[model samples]
Target: MIPHIHRRTFGTGSRPVLAIHCSLAHSGAWRGVGAALSDIATLHAYDLPNHGKSGDWDGQGVMHDTATDMALAVLDEIGPVDVIGHSFGATVALRLAIEHPMRICSTILFEPVYFAPLMADDPGFAGGYRHDTAAYDQALEAGDTAAAAKAFNSTWGDTAAWDTLPEASRTYMAERIHFVRDSAPFLMNDSADLLAPGRFAQATGPVLLMRGETSPWAEDLNGAIARRLPNVQEVSLPDLGHMAPITHPDRVATHVRSFWAAQGQGLRSARL
Candidate 1:
């Protein structure tokens, strides 16, 4: 059964667009970017299960699958639309484009955390990533949810320190830290079968893959994804990190607008 996802619409344009936020964030994270794109496209953003106002996960099926299903339900309701996602959300966007190409007009992926490709192709980086994140893993194993959340956030979160965050924010993260573990099967192991041969090549539409130049693993991971895509444009934002979409939405939206415009021009030329 498709879970009831909580969503909020941004922008006032007729062209529809879907924006998926990264893990540990809610639909509101897209406010800045969505507002920036409001002139040309209406952006619809949703909170994943157990995040924001959405209901809790029943712990029944693969968490990633459940999240993807929630997004799919929204897509079906909104019809074919350009989709944008960040981090884990970007993985969902990629899957939707690859598996339901007919339903996606174009796609923008902001630092998708599809680690399987890198793990298989570059074991050195994979090892380094695991080594860097071992503390978070250890905390999870020890059943230290708060410590796990702090460790995870220290690495992937914004430049702010964990202790600097508001107490409520810290509490929120601690409650959902288990999602990091629940997401491992798909993000780390390719449980969704997204890497199966010929699957990525199936998304023939124009794709814009954006990453922050400062992000440690984004270049490598996005590079891996770019190699498999038939049509893709890569952009590296200066001085930004993995959380750029949330931290610097206006900057990200500038590139988004440019990419969307370029695609529009190409479509017009093709029709001509």
Candidate 2:
């Protein structure tokens, strides 16, 4: 049971919006965006099973199971919700909508990472993701916190600004890093080669696949996702990158609101 926690604020009768966080970040990461959404929604910001208040993450399968369990926990508490996810959380949101089509009104996925073919695989990118996962595990086990932090800073090595984060920030990211699969080797060994896009084709709701203008997708991952989804709404943030949702909360919120407004009754009438 990966314990999922949520922090929320909003009006009672407004549309319900649930924001799921990216890897490592907890519910607190949504504070800025949640506040924006609250103006027109009853927003709920979720914390991954072990990352925040809901600290127990023990679950059946691998990471996907943890994501599904967290979704169930959220639904149990609030009945149904309109979901929004960032990075890895986007992947979770898609999975939950597929597994529990009746529990979600709509979904917005911002650069979901579980899918790999979308990334113009440099072969190096895949190697790096796996390598860093292992390095972090090794550092954690050896109690070398600084090494762990340095490894983290380099994981997203391709990101132009990742390496520029101050040493203190890197240290902080390192100190707080949590890896259920130790390092990259474990990650590669434990997970599948790539997330199966077909798994989500049957989800009974509209999917808004978004990517930042300067994202590292190397190609049209958003378009690929759109092709796979039954009802897809695709958008690209013009003046932003992969971190746009965090850096530009107002824009992200506006995107969500606009997309929701455009959704016809067909989405609202879905099981969830």
Candidate 3:
């Protein structure tokens, strides 16, 4: 059984929307971005099992189980939705779509952190991640939150533009990264090829798989997955990297808005 989960929702309209946070981050990442998308429809963002306001899942750290609980929780909390995910959250979004085909209208993934092949291309990538996690955990246990935060920022927690963030944003992340360091990798569901075969290869809804042009690796795998999906759209943002939503929210919003517009009234008229 899963524990209770909490989410933040925005907007109020016919189309329901949800955003799942990447590791080392929380639903707050989508605050400004969600505001932009909310006008078109409703938006909801999750805090993950141990992140944000959600209760910890204890031993259920595996990605599949976490994704399952989250998928059920989101639909139960805000009804069915169209999901958008970034990084590890995107991987969970993909899993949720596969596990519960009936809950999603459409899916958008921005650089899901699918390891395996991606990590293999760069030896020690996953190992480095594990090393960072351990180091941060040690730092936290030693009561050196600054050192822990610095260790995280040195790897995945800190961003090039993070110091410029507002005080509130900084505070929010400071409180959230503890859960991120604890929960993200466990919810990654990394397989030999990243995602499951029939899951990504034979998806049932519209999937917008995207990557940044300057992104160092993993585009090949994401592209390959996109090609296999029945109704998938592939996109690349040359100027963007891992932080597409933050680096180019306007562009991402445009691409999504256009996708939604093109579908028009025909968009998921019949529920999956």
Candidate 4:
């Protein structure tokens, strides 16, 4: 069954861009970045299943595949577009660029949580990541979803304190925390086979891989992905973390603009 995806558009620009938010976040999460890029791109973001107003995942197939299909539906409607994604969404964006290169002109990936590279190239970092998230894993095992959510957020979320977040935000994260676990097969194990020999070469267009300097695992992971791509530029944002796109949208947008400019796509005035 096709999940009913809820989409939101931002910006008034000639370029069509699909924005995919991180896990546990809805399409609204792109508002800040979208506004920042209003002059150059129109962002079409969608709520993944079980997020925002979208219907729940029916558990019939791989959740990552389902999410990718939902994003593909949006791509089909919009025609060729540049893609931007954060965290888990970045993984989906990468998949789209690899599998549907003709439909994607470029891709900007922010802190994609594809850990398979770490396991292969830097087992120590992968082991450390597992150790760091052991508490979250234990909480999930114990059926303490709230605790798991807190643990997960503390590690990957912006510098905000869990207790400082609104009660509603906490509840929202807790309700969707299982997605973190459910995504393990793809993120940790690379169930999608995205790293298969010659797969990264499929994306022939320019690829911008950005990550926060403060993110413990981002540099190594992005490095692994960058090494595989043919035309790739890697940037590390100073003082930013995994959620830089949300907490520091303007800074992130600056890099996005620079990347496009480097590719000879200059910014244009927003469409009326």
**Top-scoring candidate (lDDT):** 4
lDDT of 2: 0.66
Q: Which stretches of candidate 1 lie above 4 Å from their native place?
A: 265-272
Residue-level lDDT of model 2, residues 80-100, one tens digit each, is 778888876786687677767
TM-score: the better of candidates 1 and 3: 1
Which 10 consecutive positions of candidate 2 have the poorest summed lDDT?
A: 181-190
Per-model C-alpha RMSD: 2.1, 4.4, 4.0, 3.0
Q: Give the distance in Å from residue 172's predicted Cα in candidate 1 to where it truly belongs.
A: 0.8
Query: Measured by TM-score, how close is model 2 to the native structure?
Result: 0.76
User: CA lDDT of each candidate?
Assistant: 0.88, 0.66, 0.68, 0.89
Candidate 3 per-residue lDDT, tens place, 165-263, comes to 676756655665565445445333353233445655445878888888766454765764565567888888876777777657777777777777766
Encode model 1's per-residue lDDT on 1-272: one tens digit a residue.
65679999999987788888888888999999888888888989999989999877789878988888898888879877889999989998998889888778889999999998888788788678879999999998999989999998988996689999999988888999998788889889999787888988899888999999988788999999898899999999989999999889899999988998888745423422
Cα TM-score of candidate 3: 0.76
Give the C-alpha lDDT of model 3.
Answer: 0.68
lDDT of 4 by residue, 161-261 (tens): 99999999999999999988788888988888887888889988889999999996788889888888898998999888999999999999999989888
Q: What is the TM-score of each predicted model, taking all chains together?
A: 0.95, 0.76, 0.76, 0.95
